[model samples]
Target: MEGKLRLAKKNLNISLKQKPASFQTSSPELTEMLGMKLAKWIKKHRVGCVVFLGPFGSGKTTMIRGVIKGLTGLNNITSPSFTIVNQYAKGKMNVYHFDFYRIKNATELESFGFSEYIDSGLLLIEWPEVAMEKIPPKSLKVTMEFLGLKRRKITIGFI
Candidate 1:
């Protein structure tokens, strides 16, 4: 099992050291599969937080949908853009998805108990560049950028 986990991490382009892992995906399905791969790791490792940085219309939400689907086996997922945050639950775990684009400052997070939320369950945040400093240093940071019309380069590693 350990060996398989290691292999999965490697194939998924995830690095634990200063060297970040990066890969390119041409389709949303591939991106979602990568999200699912990340889901397995986070669940097994009990990783509490993951932050996604990318431009608007990027695959952040799509990838998150994959994570939610993988974590809960619930295929229906939506962006928490206007809603701010969305919660999904499985047998014994919960996933909190937060979108911070509309917020003016990271301070707003404090009002909603964002810090406490991190400890409650797995958190997947989008448009977190503004809140980067507030995010825990131990959390995972994922950056996705466009490389072409339909291709995106994704890098994953610790914050």
Candidate 2:
């Protein structure tokens, strides 16, 4: 895990260097496929930080469910909304999912000690609006916007 984390820590990981990809997803399955595709880009020897910005019922959890499954073959991934943080791992590879919907600002988020783990594990943050600047420069930012009742325009890039 440390070796993998070290790779992204240096900003040399291939995922960080990816071209921006946009998806028009109207179904949960498609959204999850996008995440699964993302999982393949995160090489075995590299860690990652992904920030998700979207409204409620925007398929964030579904996408994360796929990412977790693709990354570690985990089948169950509940949103960490109330729990704040949820941890999952397969062997030495660890993934931490964090929800900041309840957080009000960067100062409040700092108390969670999230930044401490940014340098190591695969950290995925939902509702990270308040801590954008606090995240790593190489971090991937996924922004989801409503296009219709069941459609969303998701943009992925390094921010």
Candidate 3:
């Protein structure tokens, strides 16, 4: 088990070096697919941070919600737009989902100790443009763009 785990880690490191990013088909169905893929990937990594960026009305939040629903081990998923941050847990791992669309400044995020949360859990941040300066170095960036009323294009990258 230990050797397998080590080998997996080594392969992941090499893969990250060779191709640190991935893009997938986007739509309500594709969004769900991306979410499931992301969830599975996160399970292997155990923990990481991610940020989602998109213009208003883009389906960034929707894609995440779909992922949470499709992936059972992850805790119940809900939008944190009004609450600022929502936390879900699966076993020992935690996923902190945040929406800063209504937030204007870093100060608003400071009260939440946004830095600490970004470091601690698998952070999924929406409307990250408003708080780009606050994102941790390990955070992966996911950018979504509206392709149609019900479609989106999402690109995932490690930073």
Query: Could you tell which candidate, 2 or 3, scores higher by lDDT?
Result: 2
The candidate that wins on lDDT is 1
Candidate 2 displacement at residue 82 in angstroms:
0.4
List pairs with backbone clashes in candidate 1.
none
Model 1, span 1-159: residue lDDT tens: 433343345565454655877777777877787788889878876788999999986799988988899999998799999998999999987999999888777678677667777688888999886677778767998899999877788888888
RMSD of candidate 1 to the truth, in angstroms, is 4.7
Q: Higher-TM-score candidate among 2 and 3?
A: 2
Compute the lDDT of residue 36 as modeled in candidate 3. 65
The TM-score that candidate 3 achieves is 0.76
Clashes of 3: 0
> Candidate 2 residues 66-95, lDDT tens each?
788889999889989899999998997799
How good is model 2 by TM-score?
Answer: 0.83
TM-score of each: 0.87, 0.83, 0.76
lDDT of 2: 0.78
- Candidate 2 clashing pairs? none
* Model 2: residues with Cα > 4 Å off, grouped in runs: 1-19, 44-47
How well does candidate 3 match the true structure, expressed as C-alpha RMSD? Answer: 7.5
Question: Model 3, 27-72: lDDT tens per residue?
Answer: 4555655676676666675546678888876767776775565445
Give the whole-model CA lDDT for all candidates, comma-separated.
0.82, 0.78, 0.66
